[model samples]
Target: MPDCSRPNRINIDLGPYKQRWVAYCALHQLTPSAAFRQVVAKLTENMATAGDAAAAPPTTRKHRKEIGLTDAELRFVEACAEAEGFSPTRWIIALIQARMGNGAQFGQFELAALGKSNLILLTIARQLRQIAGMQQGLAGGPMPELLPVVAEVRTRIANHTAEVAQAIARNIERWHGK
Candidate 1:
């Protein structure tokens, strides 16, 4: 995610072309704010995720690009962010980042949000076998006591992960500007 240290404010006056583009976006059922976000998402969709923040050096901030939004539009964004426990700035960043898929790489955020939890679920089978081996050590044969609980948790997480992935897929399709 970009350094969203402040709220993204479009304080500059739009040139004529920009004015027309904004109007066209409104004609397409997208608000000016949503259009700006869509444009940004398209621009950055293929960019790689940045280096780890812990390993990155801090630097002076550069001027950020701004867009023009009406007071009502800005207020709506603020309200949505607040409802989601995010500052308006973070919410804007999230909007852009959500649109930027992981491309070919699986970053932490992508893994968590996508079905990479499947990887964790995959391990449960082997883990159950290991637990069964331990039980064999305690007795003389395989013990399946923990299997049911482990399987139940695995199924639940898988179902939840699928639900989240489906929701994200629908959102992307809706916002991808078909």
Candidate 2:
């Protein structure tokens, strides 16, 4: 085999444990070069340990209390949680975190966006109905000439709905990653 020993000419500072290092090498049946390699391996392992320590999850404390809710409201909360695929407690925790402006919270932004998008769709639908009525008045005919306008409005609604769906997908993906 090729030489596995490290060069002894290299200078190293053993600090206060220099004598202990010599004894440890003798006890472990290691040459000076092998002892140095072992020390380096230990140091590398400790560096990895420090990195793991830094990445450790933050601590959390939970305090629970009983809160009275009307039966109807409790049922509604449960229903909402079921629809969202979350436990009622987790859903409530998400809500509280959202209200507290915690970035780690889930669903709040997407929920708000979905609500707003639905409202916009409703408004667009209402406008289309109003325009159809106006076209009927203008043309004074059985079938209003507003068919094209109605078609255009329908297309816009579809586009808006698709956009909202895409946004929801993205939000869901982000939540899953979290």
Candidate 3:
């Protein structure tokens, strides 16, 4: 084969480790370049042990993305996509799909929740799996860095729920004149 070990080429040169890396990339749906870039980025951040990196500052997102479109701008995008034989919505979705990183599958998150809550929970579980995959690509595993953030988010949600429940209870008491 050609000299694939040059940069920007997918060359599996490390025997069993190469095979395992290929398998992992396939499983996680990550392009080797993207995966390698993530690792490089992590290394740039800090070269401490896994425990030390996990305890370091919170891992920030790769980048900030925002979509802003006025009606005229949206119409223009629609017109362009339509001229290219796709609807504006589909064009936007295609762009997003192409830009998205590879996803990972995690365990079944089936909880005995009412109505569509299970669906939301399951979606969360899947997204968390993807996040873990990204984190792994960056810095191995055991994401202690995310623990505090997750806990704070959970606590905030619980407090908000409690406040809403208390408000509803008070309203019910007023309605019943009790």
Best candidate according to TM-score: 1
Please give the lDDT score for candidate 3.
0.57
Show where candidate 1 strays beyond 4 Å: 1-61, 65-68, 83-85, 94-130, 134-147, 163-167, 170-178
Model 2 TM-score is 0.32
Which of the numbered candidates is closest to the native, going by highest lDDT? 2
Q: Write the per-residue lDDT of candidate 3 for residues 104-126, one digit (tens) a residue.
A: 11111111222235454565576
Rank all candidate structures by their lDDT, best first, as comma-separated numbers. Answer: 2, 1, 3
Clashes of 2: 0
Pairs of colliding residues, candidate 3: none
lDDT of 1 by residue, 1-178 (tens): 4446756855446777787977798789998878888887786655525535534455568558787889999998888666545677766666665667522222234445555556666666667676666666766654566667667757867786786676556445533533
1-178 in candidate 2: lDDT tens per residue? 4345854455678899888888988999998778887767786775667677545555587888777889998997788666665587887776666555454343545566677787878878787788867766874565555676677788878888887877666545444444
lDDT over C-alpha atoms for residue 50 of model 3: 51
- Of 1 and 3, which scores higher on lDDT? 1
What value of lDDT does candidate 2 attain over all alpha carbons? 0.70
